[model samples]
Structure formats: C-alpha cells, structure tokens
Target: MSIVAFDLSRRLVAEALGTAILVATVVGSGIMADRLSEDAAVSLLGNTLPTGAILVVLITILGPISGAHFNPAVTLVFALRRDIEVNAALAYIAAQVAGGIAGTFLAHAMFDLPILQLSATARTGTGQWIAEAVAAFGLVFAILAGLRFRPDATPWLVGLYITAAYWFTASTSFANPAVAIARAFSNTFAGIRPVDLPGFIAAELFGALLAVAFAGWLLAEPKPPTTFKAAE
Candidate 1:
C-alpha cells in the first residue's frame, strides 16, 4: 500500500500505537526482568533484548504509516530537515508523549503494580549527561546512515545499535525523551527521576540535531571525481 493510503488521523493512531507498544516493551520487560532476576546484569540483559527486538518489529510494521518515529528527538530531526511539516511534527510529538505515558500505565496494570508513581531513581551528573548525548548521537546516527545506505535494513540497524547502546552508555541509553518521560512514571529498573528529565531531554535533542548536521555532510554524494591537468 502507498504511504498515503492512511489519513492523518490513521497515521497518528499508528504513531501512538507504535510508541505505546515500544514503551510497554521497555517498561514491562524492565519490571519483569527486575522481578525474575537477582543479578542486575541478568535483569538488564533481559530488558535490553526485548526493547531491541520490539523496535525492529515495530519499525518494520509501522514505518510505512508514520515513518515509525516513536521519539520526539527523532521528530525534531525530521522537522529540522523539512522531512515532516512543523505542524505534523508537533502532533506527532504530542501523540508520542501521550502514548508513552499510557504505555507506562499499561505496564503497571499488567504487572498489578501501583498505577501512580514517580521515579525516585536519580540519573544525573555530567557523566550521565554526556552518556545521554552519546546515546542519542548513536541512535540518530544509525537511523540516518541506515536510511542513506540501506533503507530496507534500517529497522535492524536501529535495533542493534540501541541494543549496544544499552550496555555501552552510562545512562542505559535513554536516548528518547518520550521513553525517558514514560519511564519516569515507573520507578522500576528503567526509571529515571523527573528531576533528571530536563538534562536528558536536552542532551538527547542536542545529540539528535548534531546527527542531522553531521549526516547532511557525511551522507552527501561524493563530488564527481575530478583530476587536475598536468602542467606542460
């Protein structure tokens, strides 16, 4: 089906649903992992796998509809690039944020945990800030490069990159502002305190923008190979 097959409302629904599922996978798996394993490493691995696997599935299925951008930082990049209109980007961000929060609540309900809770898990300091920046940078960079060189493999590229980022980044790769905000509502393994939201969000946005700028240059077609004439 053509991308235009869906209307704006339908596309919005797709975006919301995709983001919800992604968040649910992240939040729910984190909760389950934490409960099932006493080893923090084992729990983190469990959480990491589901999050990465779900991203590949979600993006492949939902991408044709809404480009499968479940993160506000991503939407911001597209908006800056004029790939998506400002108004639509705003709407997408709204849907993403709303859907993310709902996903957190859904996970809570599924786990029979308290519905209302705020994360007290502090994720702060310059290290975390830099880590967040690096995480977002890598995430956006992967998407940009994958789209440029291999659109068909973009989903896997993103999934694999994020999986690596989860282990490599100090902040556990909360590269998405929406995901971070949603995670804040659940004080489980994936949670980040609301107070830390600003720094992470800022770092993520900054990193995303940097990726766009760098990709613009990096992905450019090499200028036609030209050779200077030898002097007589």
Candidate 2:
C-alpha cells in the first residue's frame, strides 16, 4: 500500500512495530549468538546476519507505511529535508524510541533474562566515537543514495551496509539513537552502557546532519540553463 493510503495512526503503529521487531532481532540474535558460539567471530557473525536479514524484510514491509524509519536520526534527516512534517516527525521519533525499549523487554522475556537492567558494557573511546560517526554517516549516505537512484534497492543496500558495518566498525555500528538508548537498557551481548549514550548519540546526529548536507548537494536537481539569443 502507498503512504497516502495509511493514516497517521497506522503509520505510527507501523513505525513502532517495525522498530520493535528490528531491535528484538538485533538483541535476540546477539543473545543467541553469544550462547551458541564459543568464538567471538562466530558470535558476531550470528548477530550480524539475522539483524541484516530482518532489516531487509522489515524495510520492505513497512517502508510505505511509515517510511520505515526505525531510527530517530533518520526521522530527523527526513525532517531536515522537509520530507516529513515536524509534528509527525516528533511522533515518529517517540514511537521508535518507545518501541525500541519495549523490544528489549520482549527479547528479555523470550530468553528468560532480566527485563530491566542497565548494561555494564563500556563502549566508549575516541576511536569508538569516530566509528559510530562513520557508521552513521555511511548508513545515511547509503539510504539517501539508494532512494535517489534506485528506491527498489534500498532494502538490500541498507541490509548489506549494516552487515558490513557490524564487522568494520569498532562500535558494531549502533548507528541509531533510539537503538542505542534501548540497548542501554539491556545487559545482553548487544548492549551499550548508559554512560556512553551521549557521545554515541551526538556523533550519530552529527553524522546524519552531514549526510543530509552532502546528499543535498550531491543529489540536487540540475537547473535549466538560461538561453541567450545571439544578437537577435
């Protein structure tokens, strides 16, 4: 269905539900990976694969409903581009953050882990911060570039990018403010400490802004040249 076919409430629900599922996949897969694998590399691959696959499915399913923006950084970028209204963008961000938290709790329930616990995982450093920025920048850039050039390929592009980022980035590419906040609530393998939230969030926002600026310039429509009659 097209975006115009869905109302605001439906769109909000789609956003919340999509984000919830996405976070559940990320956290749940991480937990399962850690349990099943003795090798850190294997565990990371397990976590990365399912998260990327689920992202492709979720985006394909929910994109038309809410633009499939499971990240607040994404919502902000769209708002900055005037693609979505400010009030609606605020609503979307709220839905995404709340859904992300709820998703963590759901994963905990499924795994019989504590539902409410702060992460002790200390993910902080200059390198980590830069990685997060780089991750976020690449994520937004891939999205904007895909949407502009080949909207049909966006899901696959995003999935592939995240899968690669999970390996390449020091921070494993949280790349999303809402996901980072939700991750802080979990003590699982994918968790990030609450203390490190500010740095990650700041870097992510800056990265998204940079993507907007860069994409705006790179993707701008060409203007028609003014014609001058030759001494008519």
Candidate 3:
C-alpha cells in the first residue's frame, strides 16, 4: 500500500479497536461498581479507576496507531488544530459515536438490564458548567501538549492527568463525549441521562476546541524536529 493508503487503513482499524476497548472498560467497570458498593464515593472510585487505567493503557497502545482519539471531541480538537485530516477526523468521530451506542447496548445485555436506567449525567447551573468547562480544557490541553511537544511523556502523563481530572472535576471528569454516551447505558453507577447528553457534550466539545485554539496561539507551532518522526 502507498504511504497515504496505509495510513488510512491503520486509522480506521485503530478507531474500531480503541473504541471497543473504551466501551468494554467503561461498561465492565460500571457493572463491577454496582456489585461492589452503594456508597457514592466508593462507586466513584470503582468506576473512575478502571476507566482511567484503561485510558492510560489504551492511549499508550493506540496513540501511535490513531492518536488514540477514542472520543469525537478529541478528534474535533485535533482536526481544528490541523493535527489530523478532515476526512479521517470525520470517520473517526463517526466510529466513536457508533461504538458508544454499541457499547451501551452491550453493557445492557451483559447486565441483564436492557432497559436499565443508566447513571445519566446531569450537572446544571453556572458552577457545574464552569467545572465541566475547566475539566474539558485541562484534558484537551494535556493531550495536545503531550502529543505535540512531548510524545515520550504521553503514557503516564495522560493516565495521571485523567486520574486527577476524575477526582477533581465536578462532572466526575467526563472529558470524553463517546465515553459519556456509552456510560448512559450501564445505569448501574456511571450512566448519564440521555436528555442531558447533548448539553454536556456541547460543553465538553466547546471547551476542548477552545483549548486547542488557545494552545495553538500560545504555544509555538509544533514544528520541532521530532514532530516529523514516525509514530512507532
């Protein structure tokens, strides 16, 4: 295959695999949390830890393969930053949304709660909105900086950033639209309300876009010699 064609195929396969892993981890963690404890804090940890761990591992594993976008908003930010091609970004985003829906259904089936009321997300008012914005900005900034200027630092840095965001952010650090949508199906401990999904996703995506724009303006173009290095 030509270089461009090979790159295209790799991206699609990576999106499929990354999304599968993301949903599996998210749904699996929710099921475990439901069975383990009813306390909100314990449940939070149970859900966040698994998701964080999975994200860390998957980003490390799939970052080179597909930039480990795993989320539609992330892809949007990358596209806006001109780090990814438009067509590929659209394809990745579509894959993410579809994967999220599939993941939610799978989770429902696995838990024998096909109509289970997921732990839908709902954080309204000014304070909650601010919190969500901050969380999304931090997440996208970390990803952009890590990928652009410090590729070698991604694995652990990305993991740690997500873990911290989960604990600190008021929205429980959703940071990912696809994951948010997928979590709505579990209804066990980490589901978001379908009604609230659109607004929350908008906030998160807008925040990420702002971050990408700011990062581009504030930071130098990632024209460092290493930027040209091939993904491993």
Candidate 4:
C-alpha cells in the first residue's frame, strides 16, 4: 500500500489544504475589498458574499475528500455528533490552525501588507456577541437539518445561510474558528483584534455546543425509503 493511504493522515492533509483554500479566499477577498471600496459595510459584504460562494463550492468539492471542515468549531460539532473520531478531530483542528496561519501569510505576501498588519480574530461587545451566537447557531442548525433531510443540499444551503448571516448579524457572522484565525492576518475591514480572540472563540464555542445539544432533537432523520444520496 502507498505510505499515505486513505486514512486520518490523508484526511488531515486534506483539511490543511481545504483550510488553506478557505483562508486564501477569505483574506484575498479582504484585500480586494480594501483596494476597491471605502464604505466599510459595502466592503464587508463584498468580501463576504464571494467568501460564502467559495465556501459552498469548496465544501461541496472537498467535503467527501476531507469532510471540508476547515473550522475547529465544525470539527468539534461533528465529533460531538459522532460523525468523526477524536484523533481525527484533533488532527483536523491542527491542520486547520496551521493552514489558517499559512493562508494569512500568503495573503500578507500577495497584498504586500506589512507582516503584522493582517486581520486578527474578530470580536465585538454584547450585541455583536449575541449576533455571533445567533449566526453560529443558525449555521450549525441548518447543517444538521440538511444532513438529516437533504444531504445533497448541505453545501449550497450552508453557503446561502452564511451569505445571509454576514448581512444580518451585527458581527458579520464569522462562525468558524479557522476563518477567524485566518482573518487575523488582514488589516483590512475584515480584520479582527487579536486581543479579542478569546471572547470571539468563546462565543462561537458556546453557540456550537448549544447547537450540538439541540441539533439532534431539532433534526430528525428523513422518513424511510428516502435515504439521501451524494450530490452530483
């Protein structure tokens, strides 16, 4: 057998690659927004819409290959739901963090930003915290519901939800840990404050855990004879 067989190691590598792609798109879009727009809200949406589109496309393309986690929050949810094992979840998280940093650095190089001027972990006060919680809860809830009723629709629905959340939430709905980490690299409008990383992560984790507990009850499996097949 090949040394890197179809196993956790390969899956971890795929997570790394997926996370890297995610961050590249995220930060690159931020660079584009900064270069192109002066209106912060418009700039935020400009970056977010495309980021959502890319996320859906990438997740659809890479979900089977690596589960397309790209986020520790998602990985942890999957693990809690028994969709992935512990070791694999840990590996996925590690890859995600590494890939996020790599993607930030790549964006730094691409935009010719100062080495330390990249975005940081986004955070907000109480109102924004509530917004983040709601956004994250909505995302995980939608994912679980899709998995239960329409597995084939998961990617697209997720993308749409994220896109909407970006506009709706006060904090612009940064629901993923890896995405937050990657955002830390850009000093553009999308940038988060490094000092606020802990709060953002805590809010996200709270949302995730809350979603996990409720997801099982909220999302029951589809009725018999309606088993979901993979998307085409």
The top-ranked prediction according to lDDT is: 2
TM-score rank order: 2, 1, 4, 3
Residue 207 miss distance in model 1 (angstroms): 0.7
Residues 21-66, model 4: lDDT tens digits: 7787778887788778888877887788888898788788778777
Q: How accurate is candidate 4 locally (lDDT)?
A: 0.79
List model 2 lDDT by residue over 2-39, tens digit each: 24467889999998998899999999999999999989
Indicate the TM-score of model 4. 0.88
Off by over 4 Å in 3: 1-5, 115-121, 221-232
For each candidate, the alpha-carbon lDDT, in order, equals 0.91, 0.92, 0.74, 0.79
List the candidates' TM-scores in order. Answer: 0.95, 0.96, 0.84, 0.88
Q: Which runs in model 4 stand beyond 4 Å of their true positions? A: 1-5, 118-122, 221-232
What overall lDDT, based on C-alpha atoms, would model 2 receive against the true structure? 0.92
Candidate number of the best TM-score = 2
Model 2 residue runs over 4 Å out of place are: 1-3, 225-227
Q: Candidate 1: what lDDT?
A: 0.91
- Pitting candidate 3 against candidate 4, the one with the higher TM-score is 4
| C-alpha lDDT of candidate 3 relative to the true structure | 0.74
lDDT of 3 at 227: 47
Which consecutive 10 residues in model 1 have the weakest lDDT in total? 1-10
With candidate 2 superimposed using the best TM-score fit, by how many Å does residue 97's alpha carbon deviate from the native?
A: 0.6
